[model samples]
Target: MFSRDSRAETRADTAKPGAIPTQPPRFSGPIGVVSSAAAPSYQPASPDRPTSILGPDISIYGEQLILKTKGSLLIQGHIEGDVHGETVTVDDGAHVKGVITARTIAIQGGVKGELKGSNVILHEHSVVEADIIQERLTVADGAHFEGSVKKAKNASEVTPDLS
Candidate 1:
């Protein structure tokens, strides 16, 4: 039989540093909010790249990489550079001042440069002031466009000079 004094001594001996006591574990409920003593810091994601811009009428000596995003491309800023992509769409207030090359291009905004694409659609209220080259093109009513379009080249057009 163990006495009460023996149990107290055992508890004190088991309370040594880095030792697990033989007591029933206590459980705290799920954590809700965490408190921080210092102000939070801004941590950017890995492999961060710099974004460059061009002023109007400023000719770029080399290709300016605007973006390679997989999601929607929204440009409220001015771009005096060309864009090449799989699909491109411009919102109503956007103003692009450079050439665009894409598989499918839709413009509901104002563009001041040339455009080349496999399929092009110009929505109503859109305005274009440059030339366009595409395989298929659609211009909606009330859309203002003052550009010449060249249809897609056919096999006979490419196999020329055989007089």
Candidate 2:
């Protein structure tokens, strides 16, 4: 066994007070100490999926109905009764004669009745002859719209882009 004095001799010098001891260089590349500043702050954008504002499933009466869904309803038929939904869409080939109440209504067809919605979009192929109440409305070029529209809420400028 070595004596305390001999063991002390084996050991080198100690670090001075208040002095930080240097660490041996690591074999791996520089270790990144990730601070909050190194990382980017991020916020995901809201999805464009249209949510249902009101009404249940769609209902039709005595009219040829061809329906497509993209978080909205597409109607290609002759509607007699009242039509209601969150987002109601009518194709250019459709011919409807009824009252429609919805959150957002898009028409590329021929409609002859009263229409109510928060937002209304009429395409170039549309021919509408009805009184409309909406927050926002867009009518495309060549679209024949013969209706008085009442703005329900403050909205952006109207555009003539049917599709």
Candidate 3:
């Protein structure tokens, strides 16, 4: 088998005595990196809990998973587990198959489970097939839901932060 690796004539053994050696020129582009150590660390301005978002690329499956957040929770990805947050929003295009417990719930995606909240709203693009227990429930005109809705005895008592 013949190889063309030597086609560039880079072999030093084939060079003539006292002759200059040549190499392929390399050009530098505008690639650079910034060091964080050069700057001081950042400090939080407030004590409020930051919101948690499950991005579109996130996917959780297999055994049931449980997620709990003190602040608001947004689901824009796929989650096959239970979620408990102060306020939970299932954004459009999101897929969740589990129980969702929150003070306020807004769903605009696909959900299949039990939803317990003080106030729950199914947006126009929502597709929910699960039982919902809420004090106030609103289903948009274009929303598709196949589940039973029950009024909670004490809506205000339906809290997301359950220890």
Point to the candidate with the largest lDDT. 3
Query: Tens digit of lDDT per residue, candidate 1, span 1-163?
Result: 8334665433423467878667532211111121223221212212332212222333333366443433223344455666655555665566777877666566767888887877777766679997987877777676789979888685232121212
TM-scores for candidates 1 onward, in order: 0.52, 0.51, 0.68
Residues forming the 10-long window of minimal summed lDDT in candidate 1: 25-34
Summarize candidate 3's per-residue lDDT along 111-163 as a digit string, tens digits.
99989998787776689999999987877677789989989988555677556
Could you give me the TM-score of model 2 versus the true structure? 0.51
For residue 82, what is the lDDT in candidate 1?
Answer: 68
lDDT of 1: 0.55
Runs off by more than 4 Å, candidate 2: 1-71, 153-163
Q: After superposition, how far is residue 87 of candidate 1 from its true place, in Å?
A: 1.0
Looking at model 3, residue 149 earns an lDDT score of 90
Q: 36-106 in candidate 2: lDDT tens per residue? A: 23321212112453322122233356553323223444565555555665567665566667776666677
lDDT winner between candidates 2 and 3: 3
Q: Model 1: runs farther than 4 Å from truth? A: 1-72, 154-163
Instruction: Name the better of 1 and 3 by lDDT.
Output: 3
**Model 1 residue pairs with clashes:** none
CA shift at 19, candidate 2, in angstroms? 65
Top model by TM-score, which number?
3
